[model samples]
Target: MLMYKVTKENGKTVYTPHFPPPLAALDGKTVELQGYMIPITSGFRHNTFMLSVLPIQQCMFCGQNGIPAMVEVILSDSKKEKMSERPVTIKGKTVLNRKERNRLEIWVTDAVIM
Candidate 1:
């Protein structure tokens, strides 16, 4: 059970999990996550949705590859009828590995296709 706020403000608060927590090991492990869809790179793909791991209020206009360490997951396909501003629950086996001083990115393996 973990949660990261992906909202950004003038003084946005950054989130960090405890030591040796599941935040990094989620890869190859079945886990559930809940957050909003972050379509990066100007939403050109129109099919790719990234999970916002941190609280980011300002939508990124560039440097999509440099998303916050809160964890931005690339989805499998278009599961949502339309992008919802509210948060949603995502369950699947996390995959991929990403780490920084205070950041971690884990891509889920088997998302519910939504």
Candidate 2:
């Protein structure tokens, strides 16, 4: 998990995220995570989607929740399984994006539903 600290810099407040050595070491490594999928497109099959820590109704996007509790997913193949209402496990190479505050915190590529 990522940690954060708030501090004032150059007369401006800044939010800084701290990635522990272990977590930072996961970049580009294959990892498996379980979460609910939030469809990015309107279809039963999708190559890309958002994996949320909670159900879609309770996801960060639904409110002013800090740091999105979601990761962008890109399926390894176009032949992904049909979306399910329940939580699912997925495996893929992890990519951490902390440079931009507006960008996704994590991105999973070459992903497969497990």
Candidate 3:
């Protein structure tokens, strides 16, 4: 779902997502993903964070290369793990953002570290 084609629309930048059938099919299903955890909060542990295909050292949401594949992960109420630059595996339900108003294209709800 992160696959996008950038174009100019009405003199503004637009990113159109291209979801393959296989990826689209995964929606609403529990999927396991492995990526680097990017914390949004400043605490030692986090329940909400972003998982990126690229390492935390790299810019996941900025740079000339454009936004990398990332998912806003909302960990389950029972799970709150410490932040780590190393890659982590999470299991959760995949949700695709169909609304253009949303800033991110994918999300992992009810996630838990595996």
Candidate 4:
């Protein structure tokens, strides 16, 4: 789902993603993902964060991964999870950003740790 085609826009590099049919079909749908939590704020428990496909060692924040490797996560109302090194399984509605290359490519809203 992270696959993209690189191109030149205004003499600057731009990445335009082409989502596969199956992946595209998941937009606005609930899906489960297993990943390490990358907090948006410094804390032990969080309601919003980023879920990375890779562990912190090679996470997006470390510059070892790209936008596709992570998804912004917003937990369900009043729900929070403690940050941990172990992977977590989350079920949420998927939001795909197909037009914005400078922002997160995906977001999981109303997520819950399962």
Give TM per candidate.
Answer: 0.49, 0.73, 0.78, 0.79
Residues 1-114 of candidate 1: C-alpha lDDT, one tens digit per residue:
455545456897655433346555654777778876666546434344666744346445344545554344545554433455777677777754433433244565446634
Across residues 32-95, which tens digit of lDDT does each residue of candidate 4 receive?
9998888878989999888887888787557775743788899999688889999999999999
* Candidate 3 off by > 4 Å: 5-10, 61-66, 100-102
For model 3, give the 10-residue run with minimal summed lDDT: 59-68
Clashes of each: 12, 0, 0, 0
Q: How does each model score on lDDT?
A: 0.54, 0.84, 0.83, 0.85
Lowest-scoring 10 consecutive residues by lDDT in candidate 4? 59-68
- Predicted candidate 3 versus true structure: per-residue lDDT over 1-114, tens digit per residue: 347778898999988877789889988999999999887768888888889888767764445355567888999985788998889999999998876655567888999899
Model 1 lDDT, residue 10, Cα:
81
- Runs of candidate 2 with Cα error greater than 4 angstroms are 4-18, 41-43, 64-68, 100-102
lDDT of candidate 4 at residue 89, scale 0 to 100:
97
* lDDT for model 4: 0.85
Better of 2 and 4 by TM-score: 4
Candidate 1 residues lying further than 4 Å off, grouped into runs, are: 1-24, 41-47, 53-69, 74-81, 98-104
The candidate with the higher lDDT, 2 or 4, is 4
List the candidates ranked by lDDT, beginning with the highest: 4, 2, 3, 1
- Highest lDDT: give the candidate number: 4
